[model samples]
Target: MRWMKVMMALACLGVVSACSVVTGGPLVRPGEPTGVLEIANGSSHTLTVILIADCSGMSYGLNRLPSGSTIPPGRSYRFTTSAGCWDVSAGLAYGTTIYETRFTTQVRPGRLTRHTVTGR
Candidate 1:
């Protein structure tokens, strides 16, 4: 009976630990000519985010996030872009743990444009 109790306790602990796992983050799709980026913060705290295009070194948009702004723990916010070469970065503050995604423009005639991006 003592061994059965120990196994029950272990099973309960395992279930609790599995429920505490963190999930959700930024997701970008590159196959579309124009599309939006979906960002979800699953942590217990709010996250300030700045999104920028790597080519021009300009920020496309900014958001001062509050808890439950996107969805519950598994929800998200999205940002759309026109047809162009660009990249995205999300971080806590000005420059901390920034994540990036680079994309290229669709080919066009009579307009020669090239973009080279270095990820950080």
Candidate 2:
């Protein structure tokens, strides 16, 4: 019976450890005279992503992604902008929670600049 108790305790521990928590964050990098926005998913399961961008009083861009888009646990995807100031937010679909970020584009004279966003 002592061995049975030990096994039961181990099984409980395993069950508790198997539960995973999901985390999401924004990542950015420098692109060619432009800016790239990246969102990172750090969880054991898949996540639904929504992207919204504020482009300097111009147009707002919206994107929706399905679950299992599979950013994986340690990977990132990039979003690029055409013009103006850029603000990006990413959140899980069917949820009100969101992460917001603001970044500027580096447009040089006579040359186009591109910025890249990374989630590492």
Tens-digit lDDT string for candidate 2 (2-115): 999999999998775443111111122245244444555553333344444434333234343444563444556655444344544444322364333334443333333433
| Top candidate when judged by TM-score against the true structure | 2
Query: Relative to the true structure, how large is the alpha-carbon lDDT of every model?
Result: 0.43, 0.43
Our model 2 lands, by Cα RMSD against the true structure, at 17.6
* Runs off by more than 4 Å, candidate 1: 1-33, 42-44, 58-73, 93-120
Q: Root-mean-square deviation of each candidate, in angstroms?
A: 16.8, 17.6
lDDT of 1 by residue, 36-107 (tens): 444554443333553444234333444324443432333455555434454444443224554443353432
TM-score of each candidate structure, all chains considered together: 0.33, 0.36
Worst 10 residues of 1 by lDDT: 20-29
Q: State, as a TM-score between 0 and 1, how close model 2 is to the true structure.
A: 0.36
Looking at model 1, the pairs that clash are none
